[model samples]
Target: MSKYKCIIFDCDGVLVDSEPTSIQVLVDIANAYGANIDLDYGMKHFKGSFFVACKQMIADLTQRELPDDLEAIYRVRSFEAFEKKMEAVDGVRDVIGNLNLPFCVASSGPESKIKLNLGLAGLLPFFKGKIFSCYALKKWKPDPAVFLWAAKTMGFKPEECLVVEDSLSGVRAAKAGGFDVFGYTAHDPENELQTLATKTFSKMDDLLALINNEMA
Candidate 1:
């Protein structure tokens, strides 16, 4: 029925609405350090890795070097804040529950952070050991390592998996992994997703329908 036997999901903007939470945390931390950070600026540099983004934000806003231990503090605080306020992106649960194929989460976030956020969002039980983090790989998103690792760990071939992603970086990673990709445009338009996605959808039901047709 379906061309793909496995489904790989991106965690941040895709499965859970963690991006806003992450940005707010970073902004709050930056302000605490006497650097006022803007969301747009954050979106430009902080989409992939938390530390990388944090360091960049520190440098950009303060024009000062970060203490070696600053990121460690930020990490702990971010996780604490995230765990307190994380929610699934609307419709993620319904779509995931409706799917018949094997699926797993692969994220650019740290493994611990991913697990914590997923748990807070109540999606942890569904993923468990199936979660893979790019931070564990040699490189981050837009590099195929994380997705490849996830597919391999789940015993699925790259071509046998479909990646559901919401960000450009995630889409690029899925493409680089040689898998079919569906861009989720929950906040953007299909035209915006066209650059990377083979197909695009804003609604979970629409994506599920397409999956059904593809697998049929």
Candidate 2:
């Protein structure tokens, strides 16, 4: 039997190459509004968060609230960007195709954004009914509620689930839910999740190997 009964994937950076695009859109919007938010700032504060966290971060940094339509604008622009450039993480498709256990996507993104990006990357079918969004759950990462809910709904105990995540907040959430987490470090050169994740890998092929080794 596999070591894990289920695998939970963080959608943006772990499953799809959408982080750079999404971060760029955030930076562009902030800069456009003269908030002076840059890529470094975004990577530090925005990588693992939802819209409410983002709004709070912006307010904390700029001392001003984001426009009410900011999410609407971001959705349109980011969807356009995803349509033109979104792709699944390297080797992720093959990993999913060959996986022996149940898997699902649990992300901080809204359901619409998750569907759009996954569809654009041609990964929608793999996780059609298995997608869990914090927006719909009303419990964001670092809270653990979403992951706990996913585990229950998927009929897996927390210890029987493994989380593949790319953000510190995500790792924290998975850990909080009592699940082992592998931190995907391709986009996190600074190793933010190194101390929290059970293990860290920079490539999907390596992640596959790690998973296999665990099962062995």
Q: Give TM per candidate.
A: 0.88, 0.95
Candidate 1 wrong stretches, greater than 4 Å? 31-35, 57-61, 189-191
User: Compared with the true structure, what per-residue lDDT tens digits does model 1 show for residues 1-216?
Assistant: 777798899998888888877876777777777787677666555665547756776777787776788767777887887867789888889988888889999988888888888888899999978999877875787888999999999998898889998777778888888998999887553356777788988887687777767753
TM-score of 1: 0.88
Candidate 2 ranges beyond 4 A from true positions: none
The global C-alpha lDDT for each of the candidates, from Candidate 1 onward, is 0.80, 0.88
| Cα lDDT, model 2, residue 111 | 92
Per-residue error (Å), model 1, residue 173: 1.3
The 10-residue segment of model 1 with minimum total lDDT is: 41-50
TM-score of 2: 0.95
The candidate that wins on TM-score is 2
Residue clash pairs of candidate 2: none
Clashing pairs in 1: 1-215, 2-215
